[model samples]
Target: MTQQTAPCAVTERVIGIIAEVLDIPPHTITPETRVLRDLETESIDLLEFGVGLNAAFGIPVADDTVFLTSLRVHLEEARHADADPYKMMAGRYPHLSCDRVACILRTLDDGPVLSVQDIADYVLHALRAGQHEKAPSHAG
Candidate 1:
């Protein structure tokens, strides 16, 4: 696939992994589908999904990176520091779109609202970052 299509491939792969792990119909899973809400997934399902992502992409799926597991703590820190929650969250989760972070923050009580797109973005980020790290340096 070309560079333009790599993201689409990753998104589709993530959706497939989620559907397989959750035993849900792949047709029901979309980029905007919420893992917690729409998929009605539990903790074990998420764990297995993370494992699937790791195996499929050959990259370490850090809990925070893919799942945003520490979102509560991050929110607390951002509030304690009197920082802009949106900016803090955006920096913490570079893969998440700004609108997504805003939506999550708006529903602070409901906690982080992660979508399939976020997971795919994290996968793409991990893939690109891994490539950069593995690339041989020409500078001496």
Candidate 2:
């Protein structure tokens, strides 16, 4: 199945940020691009990415929300704790589809999959959530 691209204002900006951090052409980056695996990014790159995104989007991405920096750790922890790893991953990465989460869990030994779309999704989610939090409140 071909993954449909989710092109948007936020997505384009994310790609630009990623390309800059990775020192690659923006055209090479796509929603399906895997940051860690495909881009060969290190932990420092992720930190720079988090900073870049925050600077560009004004959204807090320090937590494992936008990026699945601790995917393996979380999964292992869930297994050790006798918890449903799927449920935990789905909860933490609500931006990703359940199918994607399942796929990530299945091939986790190969590597964690954190796509650009996932990052864009979390940015959009955070922006929407922030808007709601700042909305006019009748209870105020």
Candidate 3:
């Protein structure tokens, strides 16, 4: 698939994985669908989802703390600098919507379970950051 279509493919795969793990129909999972609020995803499910993402995309999908901490730090810095939090976050996470960022900010105390769209955005970020690559072959 072309670069333009790669995101869509990744989104579809993410939804498929979520649906399978959650035992929910793929049709019900949208980019805005909340993992914790809507699906009531358990901790184990989140762990499995992270593993699935890492395995599928060849990128690291660590615990939410890393991303959450980074977001909080950015927002705090933006607030201190008298910058618009949404705009600052938009600059960093171009793939996410303003509404999504707002939702994440509002839910900061809740571990930022993240929407399907959020996960897709993270995957895209990883791909753009050059985090995804084939393992080096050791054939001699």
Candidate 4:
């Protein structure tokens, strides 16, 4: 029998971010480590990490529910089996890669309020923009 891996591959990524942000080596942090008690991470940092992670994975991390440990758990549960996971989420949420979403969300004092529709819109806009950016410029 083969061991089943978590659906989402955010564990290593999360650990990388935590290590970078906290200046704690990856070897030191574990799933059981409490951000506050064990890692001594402040609330602000934790929230910021959520926003950043959201952008990185194109997934929204609700401020109320965004905690380091919780984020890890949630990401681990995300299913990417569909042909278009982002599209599937459109009717509900505009899931952006954690990095992209988080970067945009971080700029807001509160939230980016992402939904699946918003993600579709952003993605469409991004694709259009990219096409235009890549178009060859002509001079008369």
TM-scores of the models, in the order given: 0.83, 0.81, 0.67, 0.42
Tens digits of lDDT, candidate 4, 59-137: 5454543332333233334453423333333322333455544543354344233232232333233333342132233
Ranking by lDDT: 1, 2, 3, 4
Q: For candidate 2, give the lDDT of residue 79.
A: 91
Give all candidates' CA lDDT scores. Answer: 0.81, 0.78, 0.75, 0.44
Cα RMSD (angstroms) for every candidate in the order listed: 5.9, 6.9, 5.0, 14.9
Q: Which stretches of candidate 2 lie over 4 Å from their true place?
A: 1-7, 131-140
Candidate 4 CA-lDDT value: 0.44
Q: Which of candidates 2 and 4 reaches a greater TM-score? A: 2
Q: Please, what's the RMSD in Å of model 1?
A: 5.9
lDDT of 1: 0.81
By TM-score: ranked, best first? 1, 2, 3, 4
Mind giving the per-residue lDDT tens digits that candidate 1 earns over 18-58? 98988888999999887887777888888998888777777
List candidate 4 stretches off by more than 4 Å.
1-8, 68-140
lDDT (C-alpha) at residue 64 in model 2: 70
Write the number of the candidate with greater lDDT, choosing between 1 and 3. Answer: 1
Single out the weakest 10-residue window by summed lDDT for candidate 2: 131-140
**Cα shift from native, residue 84, model 1 (Å):** 2.1
* TM-score leader: 1
Each candidate's clash count: 0, 0, 0, 21
Instruction: For candidate 3, write residues 1-140 as lDDT tens digits.
Output: 45532888888888988998988899999877877678868878888888888777778775553234367788889999999988988887665667777877787777654678778878887777777767445589
